[model samples]
Target: MKIDTQGDTIRIYDFNAEECFRIARRLENQSLKLYQGIKAAIKDADIAAALDILIAEELCHLAYCEKALIDMGVDDINAEHLVEVVDTGVVTPLAQADIERVLCNRQEALKLGIALEKRAIAFYESILAETGNEQGRIALGNIIEQERGHRERLQALIS
Candidate 1:
């Protein structure tokens, strides 16, 4: 799949819950892959637990998006949500080393993840500004925060 879907990255400016759901679904898939890769690379129990938490957070975010779509009545409308996937090269298995030492491939993925989160946060922040209803604005604000949280977590992973 095309990872960095080009064209207005600011689509959330006019987005409803369905849009969020679509994007969240993509993020959920990407996060699953990321966590699985990290799990394979690390042997430590605590790091694995942290990765598990990250995966669950992504799932929860996806659920929130889906619920919003359902509530907005756009879940049935079927449109491409433009969720970008991570680069496939990052998934390659290696002999592996210190998780604290940094894996180059995972680092690349982390960089991309940060950029994606920035875009998502910007999108929702703009939407929150434009949203006519309180619920929509609140949802956008919350989603923006979630994306920001992910960005911070991913930043920590690479650093």
Candidate 2:
């Protein structure tokens, strides 16, 4: 999934429930890859353990989105097919290519994780506000809470 950004704003136009879920899953996938890469590079056992927890959490998130899409009768969601433009001031997930470049050290990795969680939380909250479906709203709320926890965990590591 590609995100189009204009300055500090992102524009995602004509997005439906399935599209939203796909985008969410894509974000989670990106997070998973990022954490995995950092974990592989970091030699600190404690930080690696923390990243392991985050990796598991991201896996669960991806599963949730997959199930949500299936429940909505969407059997297959291809990341390549994501073509919506969102216009919002929320923080966007880091691009996949930036993963290696962003991992300079443990502290930087932790900071990046915090920023990633913040972006997910903000994006979910924005979607929750606009979602009309009861199930979709509930799912978004749950994901928002999870993202908040992720942010807190990363923040604690930074502290």
All candidates' TM-scores?
A: 0.51, 0.64
Q: Judged by TM-score, which candidate is best?
A: 2
Q: Model 1: how far is 3 from its true place, Å?
A: 19
User: Which residue pairs collide in model 1, if any?
Assistant: none
lDDT of each: 0.57, 0.68
* Segments of candidate 2 deviating more than 4 angstroms: 1-10, 84-111, 126-139, 152-159
How far in Å is the alpha carbon of 36 misplaced in model 2? 0.8
lDDT of 1 by residue, 1-159 (tens): 112335865232444444445655665566567666766777666556656656676777777776777777774634654433322222233224433433334454456456546766765565467656655556666777778788788788767
lDDT (Cα, tens digit) per residue for candidate 2, span 37-111: 778886777667767767887898788878888888875665355332332333344565555544445566666
- RMSD (CA, Å), each prediction: 7.7, 5.6
Stretches off by above 4 angstroms in model 1 are: 1-13, 75-123, 126-138, 148-159
Global lDDT of model 2: 0.68
Q: Candidate 1 lDDT (Cα, whole model)?
A: 0.57
